[model samples]
Target chain A: MRRYVFFILMIALGIVIGIFYAQEINPVEIVDAPPNTLRADYQADYILMVAEIYALDRDPAQAARQIALLGSDPPADIVNRAIVFALEQGYAPNDLILLRDLSEIMRTWNPNLQLEPGGGN
Target chain B: MSLPLRPWYLLTGLLIGVVLGVLYAWVITPNEVLETSPAMLRSDFKSDYRALIALAYQSSADLGRAEARLALLEDEDPARALAVQAQLTLGEEGGTRIAQALGQLAAAIQAHREAPDDPIIASLQAGVQSPSQATSTATVPPPVVRTATADPAGQPTATTTPSGDAENGGNPTPTITPTGLPTATATPGAPFVLLDIVLECNPNIDPPRIQVYVTDAAGSPVPGVAAVVSWDGNSNRFVTGLKPAFGLGYADFDMDPALSYSLRLEGGGEPVDNITGRVCEDAPEPYWGSWRFNFVQP
Candidate 1:
């Protein structure tokens, strides 16, 4: 029984060392991160871009879909967060207007919007 | 004849340790990557990012800003990559709008490359340089500020050998053909006239094609000419030199059977009408034929 216990202790020690080495000494690099991991400033820029497109196409649905990609936050709040970030980062005035316009759209936008191709025709 | 079983348990423990180490390293508590740029996005997310950039370009028409945004992708030949993505999107359901936006952006970039001094592009550039807009442009990190031009100082010249399409004669050459010459050889007012039109029955190019080639009066291959093909009240726009394997002056549009189409250079001369695909019975498997139209500045 003592011999068996000694072997088990050795195995347990190995596991702890293995975890420490992996966690501290040689960690794996996570290169391919999703868009949700984008830095706050880049995410804000991305939101600004979506706003710019919404202004041009006036397709609130597409705009909503794009903003929704930045995690599960409400689309309106996502744009608002971006607006706050853009303000803090000293983004240009025209760019801010674009972001604000997108915010207004998202605030009143439908989450279940779907396109019916050539529907009115 | 006893096998050496004394330290076997130690060896087993070490083996288990290594496996656990690998799992711990790769799966559990993996290294967190922070402050990742757009270039670090996974492949599918990168595609979405690119499509959004194209949509924004379609809206703003700010060619410089669009070019800078594309540069973040770090593509060797942004034009060819955009063209390839446009092709990929063409096959996706409901990808027409995205594909059109990509093609339009590529065409606009090419146009700006060929004729940087065009009054329209110049005015847009002026808008892009507004102090407010300029501040946001400067906000991009250093590496992301790359130009889409074929050759930037101290950067490798872009070589366009985008995957050869089975329809485009499966022979793709490693053509370092200038994707961006930055040389303004365009006589903005010079209209491209019809040089020749040849209709062919090659079964290899199926689903029919309208190959349009535009050249200068000196007969040099002129790339980046916008060709608009309209059929039955529907029109599509594509740019030349997108596929370097075909020729620098080459651009083509897919054709549906029996539809009369008109081809014209956007902002240029008269439209060539009565352009239609034909049925070629030359091969045992009869396929629709294609038309090749050549235009040159007279």
Candidate 2:
């Protein structure tokens, strides 16, 4: 009778232990948003690009004038769109800088490339 | 001779095994906990504080480098490093940012500094020798200082109208002689209020790291805190001797903006407490605390 009682207690302890193990909780993971979701960082990049283009302008006044003439004299928006297209093709910041420099050189040396601002908005 | 293995021998072996097992499990086990001590907790806190300070130092250095880079671009490398160092020591974010931009301006000054034989920046530096150049200028409205009084409660209080500079108020008779360029003339007509600040620490600075954040009524950052900072990390005393800068309601000392830090709201008259995060990159929010502080207002 004692042996039988001992066997029953052993089984009961095993069941309790199993229940506790089964109820164990796992840790949760916290994931941050992807880079594309960071709109502010992206905006900062775009603004930096715009500033770079202006930086290539000869003087502050001349740069301002050149930007203003984009629609009527030479379309800066079109240039920006072309740059954007290049970006879609995986152009980086440094590449954009080179492209901007090339555009400035063209505006200064290659008169033929300059477009009327009214041609494109 | 063996007469086979005896039952007694088997029982003896089993008894020895049981005794040994009990001893290993209870008396001699390496995993057994003897006692707990508070020293371990103190050590951990100290270690955390050190880690935070190290992180802040690294961040501050990076910011200084970035600022110095701007000056390198401008060609003013020597003064660039000084400005960067001052910004770090000043422990003000706005001042640090300004120092960064001025680093670029230093590059412009470099053209002068590089030519050891010629002194170009020497003249420009002399030309720009005004506190106004280092600080911002806000048109002080009149009668504000006269109306200003300390708040009975400890919160920041303001005067309605400014009292002009004590030396010259309202209209002053000018005695000016210009040498080609614009002369330095006192604007006695304009009324202005000066914000002279004094900072005090109540208790000892036990926790080495503390972050201070000052905000305006609208919760926007108040700039120009560095120009008026005074704190001794070692003495942990009430620090005085603050100089006002040429800017709106902003000043700071004993804090570097380059590092990430958090301010914990503590009870009345207690110095502000701060926990530092990593520097250079955006600090992970809900900072890791290593130190505490107690700021007494003067």
Candidate 3:
């Protein structure tokens, strides 16, 4: 009886230790993601909204202010970068034009400042 | 060598194993599993991830956030990567949407560059000592600021009226002038209320075309009105009194079937019409596309 009880306790102890070791080895726990997070499509839509507003107002300064909400780069640099990015992204001609027009308008509005050269059409 | 085992010992061992196994499987294991790495994500969700980053940039406008989000996809150049993906997938139904999103992203970036605190804006403001000073210093006459006239509701109101010469003649001259330019004796003047816009797709022509019509409050077609059509980053100005097939109020422009287009009457508020290209399905005579827009004075 003593031997049997001793063996049973030993087995239980081994399992408990094994569980602890397994946890230590792989500590990652699956977690649920938070809700209300923005998706990529939503982000793209926001960008379109900004472009529409810029086109409507033709106010580079105001447009820049709104764009600054997205990133730290100067508006002109951002525009130039965006142009290159858009072209690289294979954006439609009309969509590219909207960005280009904004860039041109910005350049026209501030000729003295040197803006980054745009890449391939 | 097998040890002599008792039934009680065997039963006890079995029970212990079962309980512990269940506990380990249920309580010890994590609830969520990360099935994919960033590398795997790039292969699977490259375009979607890029679009999300672009969209996120709009709300946050933070390059760092954009970078971090892009990093999850292991992309080195977020914009360029998206552009490449867009190009690769061009003509696919989803391609248009991706391209549009990319363009919006670029526009947002450009807008950010023009912010008030930007040196460029500051310099421009500083350089302009006065309106007179600016005008005097400029080599050419300052471009007129043609703000689109907005109605009480803030919507741009485009009105078409016959030019002084055209109005004098009860019957206007031929639609196309001797020089081959489509001429409309329309001047930008009285505010004709814009009633509606109609879009028609005609695939009979080689590159498709968009025809526009302008009318007055009495529903009579207004002749010699000017309209501007813009698409694929280019703009063309045309006038009514052309395309006699659609009558004096009608004007038309050839368009690429693969492209979408927007139209604004010369005195722009917002674009009066935006037409998306649809596949032409004329048996044995498929052409790119076409559209028609109707505008009226309220």
Candidate 4:
């Protein structure tokens, strides 16, 4: 009878320890994006696309090409403006495409887009 | 089962366990945390006070540099003059970073100020500034200035559109008296204005509110009338509640993570808007806690 009672006490202690271990939580384990990560601008699409391309490989011309494909409606300085915007955003080619649709929408908007006319060694 | 059970053993065991657990918690726990409370509070206060003081120093330094740069331009340096103007604008905008640092430091200090006078806390406060209440505060008076009287009442009044030394009204040859005060003087041939905004917060107190100080083209404080502070996140505009303004301007808002922010000041019959230039968001959470900044007029 005494042995059975001791066994029950050991089991109860184990359960309490297990519960405490399971319940422990880290307060700082939140996965939220840093502030000002995204901007709401017409050229942001080009910037995002350029970042994706740059991250994969360093190709300013290819990035420029991707930017030129943004939308059918052309802002006067569209390609050059996009290039500058992309550079400012520090878009690398490998960056994950967080806003793919936004890029696609921009491409559909600028149909006559072409690589900025002036670039080479 | 029917026998009388006093259960004395169970009660005694529970009491002993509780007492032992408390003793272990008090003695075995890290002493660093226990000893750090007072020093930590004092350090926090000093940090906050340092923000305001550092800002005061930076502004004074920038003002001096600007005046010197402008004075050099008068000796025929047009290119240098343009560079000076750009530098001044950068310096003016940079005031925000200083202000924010000061706000955090001040909040920490206020916490120490309100804590009970434990010897450790008292010693910490004393190590920073004397702990005695009598030494905490020492009052001083504003400087006296003598001016020629036009009106029989002899009340000094500032005239609008002051220029060409005529504003002094025959009180020519102004004397420079430095009594450890911040002053902004506009030199001839290179006029400039600096607006400083001071924000104060006491987390120990109720809801944290930021105070905005509004000054004129001169460093002199602008009083009366209210200014409205509006931001991009909130729909309603936050109007300043206090008056005569202290340094530049003040507005309070709950801290948020968004880096780019816009501030608009509309009051005293004029409206000015500004955008923050490249906020440093990727910093230690502590550094990014709270920010105080100033908006200078264009």
Reference-based lDDT, each prediction: 0.65, 0.29, 0.45, 0.31
> What's the true lDDT of residue A77 in model 3?
61
| lDDT tens readout by residue for model 2, B1-298 | 5336444454454454544544444454423432211112233322222222222222221222222222212223433443344344335533443332232222222222222232343344334322221111222111101111121111111311000011122234422111111111112332122222222222232222232322222222222222222233321211111111211222222444334333322222222223232222223433222221222221
lDDT for model 3 comes to 0.45
The DockQ score of candidate 2 comes to 0.01
Q: What is the lDDT, from 0 to 100, of the residue B125 in candidate 1?
A: 38
Error of 2 at B83 (Å): 14
Off by over 4 Å in 3: A26-121, B1-28, B32-47, B58-60, B73-81, B88-91, B100-298
TM-score of every candidate: 0.55, 0.19, 0.28, 0.20
Candidate 2: tens digits of C-alpha lDDT, residues A25-119: 22112122221121222222222223343443233232333333223435344345546655664544454664465355434543444444322
Model 1 chain A weakest lDDT span, ten residues long: A112-121
Error of 2 at A65 (Å): 24
Tens digit of lDDT per residue, candidate 1, span A44-104? 8788779878877787777777877788988899899988987776666677888888888
Query: For model 1, what is the error of residue B172's alpha carbon versus the real structure, in angstroms, after optimal superposition?
Result: 46
Top DockQ: which candidate number? 1
Q: Model 2 in CAPRI terms: which quality? A: incorrect
Tens digits of lDDT, candidate 4, B159-234: 1101111122345453322111222221334312223433222233223233333333432222211334455754
Q: Say which docking band candidate 3 falls in.
A: incorrect
Better of 1 and 4 by lDDT: 1
